[model samples]
Target: MVKVKKIIFLALGFPNAEENTIIWTDLVHEFHLQGHDILVVAPASNKTDTGLRLEAGVKVLRVATYKLFDVGPVLKGLANIMLPYQYKNALKINNIKLDFDLILIPTPPITLGKTANWLKRKTKAKLYLILRDIFPQNAVDLKMISQGGLIHRYFRKKELKLYRISDKIGCMSQANIDYIKTHNPKIEAAKLHLLPNWENLPKFEDLGNIDDIKAKYGLTNKFVVIFGGNIGRPQKMENIIELAKNCTEIKDLVFLIIGKGTEFKKLKDNVTSLKLFNVVLEKKIPKKDYYNLLRAADVGLISLSEEFTIPNFPSKVLSYFGSKKPVLASIDLQTDFGQMLEETNSGFWAEAGNIPLLKEKLMLLYKDGDLRSKLGANGYKYMAENLLPEHAYNIICKNV
Candidate 1:
C-alpha cells in the first residue's frame, strides 16, 4: 500500500484564477486522487486578508496579498516581499497545524523561501522546490531588472535561500536544470530532477467536431492560427503583430489571439493602428470555449521573447496537443522546444522575432492540409505517451 502523506503547496496561481486548468491544477487534483492530504496556501484575488476554502477535497488557504501580474512593478515587488509574512500570519490566525510530509513551492516571486523554510522546520517536512521561472536572471535577461542592481541583489539572495532550503528541486526541462546548475554552482547536483509540465488526457467524446466549432467562431474556410493563454511581456507580442502585418494580404489566413495580460491592450492597439484585417484579438474565453477554439484552429502559435536566455516552456503547448492542433512555436535560441517539435513531428518552429520565418511557416501550414493533419496527430500521440499527469505524479511520489 502507498503511504499517505500530507503535502503543503505554495503557489500564486490556483484554480478559478487565470491558471485554472494548468500545471498546479492537475498536480493538486492528482495528489488528491492518490489519497494524499493537500493544503494549498495561495494569495487572495481581491483583498489582503486570508480566507479558507475547500475545492475537490483539497484545503486551500487564500492569503491576502497584492496582485503580482498586470500591476506596476513597485506594487508587484512590494507584494512579493510581503507574501511570505502574510502566509505565516494567515496560517497562525486560522490555527492550522499539520505535520506535513512535504512542502512544494514553485518560484516566481521567490519570496516564499522563508515561509517554506519555517514550515519545514516546524513540521519536519521535506521541501521540494519547483523551479519553473529562474527569477532575477530572467528579469535581467528582459532588461526588466539590472544585474547586480539593488533589486537584483535582493531577489538573488532570496533565490539562493530558496534553493538552499529545498531538499529536492524539480525543473521543467533539462535546459532549466542546466541553467540552475550553471548559475548557482553551490547547488548540489543530487537535489535537481526533471519534472516537466503535465495535464490530464482529454477524452475523445469531449473534443467534439472541429468543423462545427470552426463555423461557430466564423473560422470556417479560413486557415486559423490561434494563440491562446497569457499575453504578457515575456511573450513578445510585437513579433506576432509583424506576422499579422505580413499575412494581411492572404485573405484565407486568419490570426486569432485569445488571452489577457499587461500586454493585451498594447497588442490590441498595435493591431488596430496597423489596420490588420487578418488578425483578431479577443479576451480570454471560458475553458470549454477555449478548447473548442483550439480544435477549430488549423495551427497553434506559441511565442517567447527573443531576449530570454532562460529556456521558458509555455504550458500552452499542452493545450494544443490535447486539441490535436499542430503547433508553430517562435522561441528563443536557448530553448529546446523546437527540438521537441522536431522529435515529435508536432509542427514547426522559428526563432522568435523572425517575422519572415514565421510568415513562411504559417503559409506552409495554410497550403497543406495533409501536413497539418499529420503533425497534429503526431503531437496528440506524443502528449498521450509522455505529458500526462500520471508521469509527473510518479516523479513527485518517488522524491517524497
Candidate 2:
C-alpha cells in the first residue's frame, strides 16, 4: 500500500470567500480524497469573523489581525516578519503537534520561509517554497525599495536564503523562473517548477439578471467598466480616472471601481472632488456579489503600472476569463499580460497610463458587439482548456 503523506500549507492570507478560495479549496479537497491529510494555516483578514467554517475535509487555523491602513505592503511585511514567532505560538495555543511529510509556504514578505525553515528543523519535513512574488526584485521594480540600499540588501539576503533552503520551488509565471535563473545560475533547473495562475469555473453560476443590481447602483443600461481588486501603486489608476473624466459627456459609459487598498481612497476622493460624472467607486464586495458584479459588467478593466515587467502577472485576468467577460487590460506594453490578451483575442491592451489609448480601446470594445462576444467566448474556451484548477493541481502533483 502507498503511504499517505501529511501536508501543511502556510500562507499569511487565503481567500476565505472569493479570492483564490475557489481554486485552493478544490486542490485541498482532491488531496484529501487521494488519502493525504491536509492542514492550512492563514491569517484571518475580515473573511473569517465567525471563526472557522469547515470545508473539504481539511482543517483551517486562522488568527485575527489588525486591518489597519498599512494592510498591504507595510502591515503585511510586519505581520510576515513576525510570522515565525506568531505561527509558533499559534500552533502551540491550538495544541497541535505534527511531524508532516510536506510543508508549502508562499513567499511575499519572504518571511514565511523562516516558518517553513523552522518546521523543517523541528520535524524533518520537506519544504516546498511557492514563489508568488519574486520579492526584493519586484519591490525594486515598483520603486518601493532602492536596489542597492540597506533595506534592499536585507531583503535580497532573505530571498536568497529562502530559495537555498527550499527543497522545491513552485513559480506562478515562466518569467519569474527565468528571472531567478538569470540572477542565481546555481539554482538547479529541475528544482524550479512553473505552475501558472488558475481558475475554478464550476464555483460560479450566473445570477440570472443584473438589471436589479445595476438599478440599485444607478448603472442601468450603462457601459459599465468594472475594475475590481486592490487599487495600489502598481495599478496606477490615475489615468483611468482621467479617461473617465474625459468621457463624462457620454452618459452610456461608467467606471465602477471596487476593492480596497492604500490608493483606493485617493482615487475615490479624486473622482468625488472633481465631480466626475461617469465614475462610481465602491469598497470591496462580498464574494458572491463580487462575482455577480463581474458577470454583469460589460467590460472588465485590468490595470497595472508600466513600471513592473517580471513577476507581475495579475490573477484578475484569470477571473475575467472565467467570467467570460472581455477584458480591457492596461499594462506594460511589452509584458506577458499584454501579449496574453493580444494572443488570446480576449481583450484589448493599452500602454499603461496612456489615457487616450485606453479611451480608444474602451470605445472600440463598447461599440463592437460581435467582437466583444467573440473575444469573451474565446477567453472562456482558453480558460476551460488551460487555466483551470485541474491544470494547477496537475502541475503541483507532478512536483510532489
Candidate 3:
C-alpha cells in the first residue's frame, strides 16, 4: 500500500477563477486522486473575500491580499513582500493546524520563504520549490529592473533565502535547471530536478463546436493564426503585430489575438493605427470558449522577448497541443522551446523579433494543409505520452 502524505501547496492563482485551467490546479487534482491530503493557500482575487472552503478533497484557504500581477511594479513588489505575513495571519485567525509531510511552492514573488521555513520548522515537512519563473534575474534580463539596483538586490536576497530553505528545487525545463546552476553556483547540484509543467490529456468535452466557434469569431474561410493568453511585455507581442502588418496583402490570412495583459492596450492601439485588416484583438474568453477558438485556428503562436537570456518555456504550448493545433513559436535563441518543437516534430519556430522569418513561417503554414495536420497530430501524440499530471505527481512523490 502507498503511504498517504499531507501536502501544502502555495501559489498565487487557483481554480474557479475566470480562467481555471493551469499547472497547479491539474497537479493538485492529481494528488487528491492519489489519496493524499492537500491544503492550498492562495491569494484572493479582487472579487473574492478571505475564507476557507473544501473542494474535491482539497482544503483551500483564500487569503485576502492585493492583486499581485495586475498592479503597478511598486504595488506588486509590496504585495509580494507582504503575502507571507498575510498568509500566516490567515492561518492563525482560522486556527488551522496540520502536520504537513510536504510543502510545495512556486515562485514569481520569491517571498514565500518565511512561510515555508515556519512550516518546515513546526511540522518537519520537506519543502519542495517548483522553480517556474527565475524572479529578479528574469526582471534584470528584460531590463525591467537593473542588476544591483535596490529592487533587484532585495529580491535576489529573497531568492537565495528561498533556495536555501528548499529541500529540493524542480525546474520547468533542462534549460531552466542549467540557468539556475550557472547563476547560483552556491546551490548544490543534488537539490535540482527537472519538473516540467503538465496537463491532462484532452477530454472530448474540451473540443467544443469548431465550426460554430470559427463563424462566431469571423474566422471562416480564413487561415487563422492565434496568439492566445497573457499578451504582456515578456511575450514581445510587437513582433507578432509586425508579422500581421506585413501579411495584410494576404487576404486569406487572419491573426486572431485573444487575451489581455499590460501590453494589451498598446497592441490594440498599434493594430488600429496601422489599419491592419488581417489582425483582430479580443479580450480573454472563458476557458471552454478559448479551447474552441484554438480548435478553430490553423496555427498556435507563441513568443518571448528577444532580450531574455533565460530559457523561459511558456505553458500555452501545451494548450495548443491539446487542441491538436500546429504551433509557430518565436522565442529567444537561448530558450530550448524551439528545440523541443523540432525534436518532437510538433511545430515550427523562428527567432524572436525576426519579423521576416515569422512572416515566412506564416505563409508556409497557410499554403500547406497536410503539413499542418501532420505537425498537429505529432504535438498531440507527444503531449499524451509525456506531459501528463501523473508524470508530475510521480516526480514529486519520489522526491518526498
Candidate 4:
C-alpha cells in the first residue's frame, strides 16, 4: 500500500497539456499515476483568465500575470519580478484552499521566494526547490545583465532568499550542486540534492510509421541532425548557425533546428543571409510530431554558449534519449554535459566554438550507421536506468 500525498507545483513554464512531453509534466505525471493529489500553479497567457481548471485529471491554477513565456528579455525579466505578488494575490481570490504537504517550486523565474513563503505560512507545506536555472549568474554569463549591476544584484538577493526557504534544493547535475555550494556558501551544503531531469520513456512502437511521419514533416530522405527545444541566448544558437554553414558541403545531411525563442529571428536571418539551404528551422511542432521527427533523425543536436560558466544540463537531451537518438553536442567547457555523453558513450561532443572538431566528429557519425545505432541504443538504456520518471518520483517521495 502507498500513501497518497497532496503536492502543489509552482512553475513559470508548463506543458499545459498531457500530450506535451515536457520535463515538469513528465515528473508530475508520475505522481499522478501513483495516485497522488497534484496541483500545478503556473502563469497563464495574457489571453487566459486566472482560475482553476482541470487538465488531464490534474488541477491547474492558472495565475493571471504579465506576458507569456519566451518573450523579449526586458519583458520577461520584468514579468518574473512581478509574479510573486500576483501569485500570492490569486490564491486569496480563489477561496478553494486546502492543506498541502509539499510545495514544489522550479526556478527560471527565480522570484518565487515570496510565494513559497506565503504558501508555507498559509498551508504549512514543506518546501522543495528544484533549481533548474541558476539565475543572475546565468544571465551574467550570457552578458544579458552585468555582474554587480542593479538588475544582477536584485535577482541575486532574490535567489538567496529562494534558497533560504527551501528545505532541500534539487540540482540537475553534480556540477550544478558543486557550483551552487561553491557560489552560495551561506546556504547549508546538505540542502543541495542532485535531482537530474527525468522523462516518461515511450517505446519506439508508439512512434508510428517513421517514414510517414518524416515525410509528413519534410524530414525524409535526409540524415537529419535535429535540435528541438528552446532557442534562448544561453543555448548560443549562433554556434548552430555556423555549424550549418560549415556542413553545407556535405550532401544529404541536414541540420533541423526546431523550437522558438527570442533568438529565432536572428537564427532564421542568418540562415537566409548565408543561404544555408541544408538547415531547416521551424517553430516547434506538436508534441508527438516532434518526437517522431526526433526518432527519424540520425542523431540529436545539443548546444550551449561558450560564454556559460554554469553547468547547464538541458532536459531536452532526455527527449533525445527517449527517442533513442544519439547526440552531437557543441558545449561550454564548464557544462559537464559533454562528460555525461562520454561516460555513456552516447554521442560526440567538442568544446563550444570548435567548429572544425565538431565537424570532424559529425562526419564520423555521418559515415557510420552502426556507430549511431550503438550510441543511440546506449543513450536509451542510460535514460531508462537513471532518468526515468519512476526513478525521479522515488527520489522526491523519499525527501517528502
Candidate 5:
C-alpha cells in the first residue's frame, strides 16, 4: 500500500497541561513513525515569541493572542473563537507554509472548520475533524446562545459545514457518532470511528507519598475528593459550593478544586464568603505532581451538564482511571462515561448538581476501601487493555 507523505494538525487553544499537549505530540510521533512529515500550529494566550522550528520530528508554531477583557467568559470564548485567524496570521508572519496530506481540527464554535476548509483548498489534505467538544449545542445547553436565534443559526451553519467537509471524524464515544448521524445524516457512516481518550500510562509512575502534598495543601489525613484541571465556565460550580456548605454531615470528606479558568475567582470568593471549612481551592499543579496527587486521592470528581449528555465525554474519566482511582461523576446517566462507570464498576454516578446524591456517593466511597479499590482497579484494567495514548494513535492511523 502507498503511504501519505505529510500531515498538519491545528489546535486553536492554550497549551499548558500535559494532557492537551500529549494528544498532538503523540499524533505527530505516530505519523512520523509511519513515514509522514508533521506540522503543528497552536496559539499562545500569553505574550511569547513567535516563529518556530522542528521538535520531535514535528514543527510547532505558537501564535500571538491578545488579552481582551481579562479571560472572562464572554471574552474568553471570543478569544478561543478568534484563534484560527490568529494562527493564520501567525503562519503568514513566520513564512511557514503548510501543504500536507492530512489535517485534524478541534471544535468549539466549530470555527476550526474554517481553518481546515482553507487548508483543504491549499493542500488538498484529507480532513479529520476531532470531535473534542460539541459546540453551539454546548453553548445552547449553557444558555450562552439562544437556540433559535440568528447567532445560533450562524454557528449551526459552521457546525454543519465542518461535518460535511471533513473526510472522517474521530469521536470519544459511540453516542457522539449517533449524535452526529442524528443531526446530520449527510456524513458517511464508514468515515466515523471511535477514538476514545487515552492515558500515557508509562509516563506515570507510582508516587507512593501523598502526605507531603496533603500537608502542603493543609489536607493531612483528610478523605480528599479532587476535581482537578480547567475550572471553566462550563463547570456550574455553585451547586457544589452549596453541597460543601450544607452537607456538614460528611465533614471528613475534603473537597479539592484545582486548575485555573474564568470561574476560579468567583468560586474562590464564594468559598471564602461562606467560610466552607472542608472545600479547598488551588492552582493547577505541575503535571507529574498532579498525577501523583490524583493517585493519592480517595475519589476523582467530574461534572457535565445534562445538555452535554449526547455528544460530550469528559476525558477526566480516563485520567481518573489512569490514576487507579474511582470517579464521582455528576452527569447524565444516559451518557458513555456514566455507562462505563456503571458497567465496569469504576466509580459512582450522580446527576449534575444533585448534591444529596453526590454527597451520599462520596461518603460511601470514603468509608469503603474495598469497594473503591475494586472500582478503581476495574477502570485501570480497562485503560491498560485498551486506552493508552499509543493505542489511540494506532487506531487513528489505521483508520486514516
Candidate 6:
C-alpha cells in the first residue's frame, strides 16, 4: 500500500487552478493527480476573490488581505507583514479543520513564519520551506532595507524562525544552500536540500503558426529575442534596454519583452525615450500565449540585477528548455545559473551589467541557426531528465 498524504501549499503567487503556470501549481497538482489531498492557502488577488473555494478539485483558501505583488514597496511590505495574521483569521472564520500531513512554503514574504509554526503545532504536520528568495538579506543586498535597522531586526527574527521551524529547507540551487550555511552557521546542513525550481512540460493543442504569432506581436520581420517573466528590480532590466541601445543598427534583430512587475513602467518609459525601434515591451500574458511567443522567437533572454548576492535561480529558463529555445542571460555572478547554462550548453551568459559580452553572445546565436538548434536540443534533453514536477514530487514526498 502507498501513502496518500494530505498536503498544504502556501505561496504568495498562484495562477488559476485550471491553468498551469508551471511553478508551484505543477508540483501541488502532481500531488493531486497522484491521489493525495491538497489545500492551498494564498492572499486574495482582488476584493471579490476572498474566502474558501474548490479549484480543480483541490481546496483553496484565499485569505482576505492586500494583493501580493505588482505594487509599490510600502504596500508590498504591508501585505507581507499582515499575511500571517490575515491567514490565521481566515482559517478560523472558514472553519478549516483538517489534519494536514505536510505543509509546503515558499519565501518572498518570510512573515508567514508565525503562521507556518502555528499550523505545524496545530496539525502536527512536517513543514518544508521551499527557500526561493532569501529575505532580509536579499532586501539588504538590494539596498531596499537598511541593515541593523528596526525593520531589518524584526524580519531577521522572522527569517531565523522560519528556518528553525521548517522540518526541511529546500533551496533552489546549491549556491543557495552554501550561502545559507555560510551566513547562518547555526543551521544544520542535514535539513537543507537542493530543490531546484521545476515546471510541468505543457501539452498545448495548438502552438499557432510561427509567422502569424510573430506578426501578431509585430515581430514578423525581425529575428526576435524575447524575455518572458517578471520585469522587477532584481531583473536589472536596464541591461536589457542597454542591449537594445547597442543593437539598434542590427536591422534584422528585435528584442521582445513580455511581463509586468514593479519596473514595467520605468522600462516602458526608457524604451520610448531612447527611440530604440528594435525593442518591443508587452504586458505579461497567459502562460499559453507566452509559449507561442517563445516558439516564434529566435532566442530567450534572462537578466538579473548586479547588486544581488543571493544565488537566485529564476524558473523562466525552464520554459525556454521546454520549448527547445536557446537562452542568453545577463545575470549576477553570485548565481550558479550562468554556470548551469555553460555546463548544459543550453545558452550563453555574461555578468548582469556586461552589455558588450551580452551583445557578443546575442550575435553569435543570431547568426548561427545550427548552433541554436544544438544548444536548444541539449537544454530540452536536460529538462526532460531533471526539471519536471515528478522529480519535485518524489523529493518532497520522500523527505517528508
Q: Candidates' lDDT values, in order? A: 0.86, 0.76, 0.86, 0.85, 0.75, 0.86
Q: Model 3, which residues run further than 4 Å from truth?
A: 1-4, 17-19, 46-48, 206-208
> How does residue 298 of candidate 4 score in lDDT?
91
Q: Tell me the TM-score of model 4.
A: 0.95
Model 4, 1-400: lDDT tens per residue? 1243888888777756755657788778888899988888888755455688888878888888888576678898888888888887777788757578888898877888888888888877888898888998998998888999999989999899999888888888999999998999999998888788898787566668889987886767888999988888878988888888898888788998999888898999989999999988889677677767877889899999999888889888898888888899999988888989999999999998999999999999999999999999999999999998888888777765
Clashing pairs in 3: none
State candidate 6's TM-score.
Answer: 0.96
Stretches of candidate 6 exceeding 4 Å from the true structure: 1-4, 19-22
What digit string (tens of lDDT, one per residue) describes model 3 on residues 35-111?
88888998876546668887555788989987788788789888888999998888889887868888889877689
- State TM-scores per candidate: 0.95, 0.89, 0.96, 0.95, 0.90, 0.96
Point out where model 5 deviates above 4 Å.
14-22, 32-35, 45-48, 67-70, 73-82, 202-208, 307-310
lDDT of 1 by residue, 1-400 (tens): 1254898999888764334566887888788888888889987777844588876667889887767767987889988898899999999998888688888898776998999999988998888888888898888998888989999999999899899889899888888888889989999988999998898776556766878877777788888899998998899989988888887788888999999988898999998888988887888566777777877788999999999998898888998998888999889998888988998999899999888888888888988999999999999998898889888888877876
Residue pairs with clashing backbones, model 4? none
What is the C-alpha RMSD, rounded to one decimal, of candidate 6?
A: 1.7
For model 6, residues 173-291, the per-residue Cα lDDT tens digits are: 89999999998999888899988889877565676687877787788778989898888888889999999999998898999999888889999999999998998888966666678
Residue 164 lDDT in candidate 6: 89
> Which ten contiguous residues of candidate 4 have the minimum total lDDT?
1-10
Candidate 5 local lDDT, residue 115? 77
- Model 2 over residues 304-380: C-alpha lDDT tens digits? 87887564778787777887889998787535767777888999988887888888998898899888888889889
Q: After superposition, how far is residue 124 of candidate 4 from its true place, in Å?
A: 2.9
Q: Candidate 3 overall Cα lDDT vs. reference? A: 0.86
